[model samples]
Target: MPHRSSTLNRRLVRYAFATLFAALSTQAAWAASFDCGQAKQPDERAICASRQLSEMDVEMAVRYDTLTGLVAMGTRGDMQDEQRAWLHERAACRGDRRCLRASYTKRIDTLKREYDQLKSRGPF
Candidate 1:
């Protein structure tokens, strides 16, 4: 059996790697979806200003992209329209960082769930 200290160390390493993976995915999401230089909305500006919000935005974007690609061709338009509506709702949160963060969190969670559904599908 493994020693307690070694087990603790292994768990810590896994946690660290998970954190690192999340950080990297969020960064890529931000870069892939928006040009920070031209960000105009209050929420966009706020996202650009805060690391947490920016990370959420990126994470959500990545999940959205993945889910969209995974879903059927016939459903693509609906997915995109739903995303647009969500964006409008998110933007309505305006300068409230808490509201914006909550919005991002909910959307990211939803998209992540949808993305996970792809795991059961065969590779095309």
Candidate 2:
């Protein structure tokens, strides 16, 4: 009957929309700061769990790498020590989403500021 066809069309539209939304959400959830395949710690796993945190991780990693290469050999040791301390602080977040978010935000901000200052000094 005509009524049956209408009902089926509506159901198909609903199904399609639901499927599209689900796919988008899943992709966003894993926006991923690092390669999930290489995640080796609870904090790393936590960072991978949320797109925002993952973004923060990616930015931090990039800045850290850039600064390390730009710094002098002697100060590179100090930078390594500072980065290790930050890692310990991040690890203390322990899968707590709020804590991890805060940690990432703070670290990202700190790295950006430090990087800006170093760049302004025109290399040591």
Candidate 3:
């Protein structure tokens, strides 16, 4: 009985260590997702940055859709052009994987221009 108990204890310790290691590795991967700017390898950096941007793109798309719908219903026009510009920029960014950084910057510039235009049109 004592030998059996010792074996069981060993197994439990092994399992616990395994679980801890797995959890740590998972946390590391998640941390990698946020360390985009600190990635050393080009591919790694690109992947990390893409993951971050992809998340932003999804959120921006949702907001853009909602705002555009409001504009269509004449409930609001403040975000119409702004959302359109964002969509355009996101599209541009998604289309070219090689120039993701540049595309993002261009998208920002486009959004700024659209915002300026919308502002000139006066308040909605």
Tell me the tens digit of each residue's lDDT in model 2 across 50-103.
Answer: 777887887888888888898788888988998899989988888888998888
lDDT of model 2 at residue 30? 59
Ranking by lDDT: 2, 1, 3
How far residue 123's Cα lies from its native spot in candidate 2, in Å, is: 7.4
Query: Cα RMSDs of all predictions?
Result: 6.9, 11.3, 13.6
Model 2: per-residue Cα lDDT at residue 105: 84
Candidate 3 backbone collisions, by pair:
none
Instruction: Give the residue spans of candidate 2 off by over 4 A.
Output: 1-34
Q: Select the stronger candidate by lDDT from 2 and 3.
A: 2
Ranking of predictions according to TM-score:
1, 2, 3
Best lDDT goes to which candidate? 2
**Worst lDDT 10-window in candidate 1:** 24-33
lDDT of 3 by residue, 1-124 (tens): 9999999999999999998789666534334323555756544445455555544444444544544553445534656655556546544544355565555556545545554665587786
lDDT tens string, model 1, 31-105? 425888888888888888777887787788878877787778878888898899999999899989999989988
What is the alpha-carbon lDDT of model 1 when measured against the actual structure?
0.81
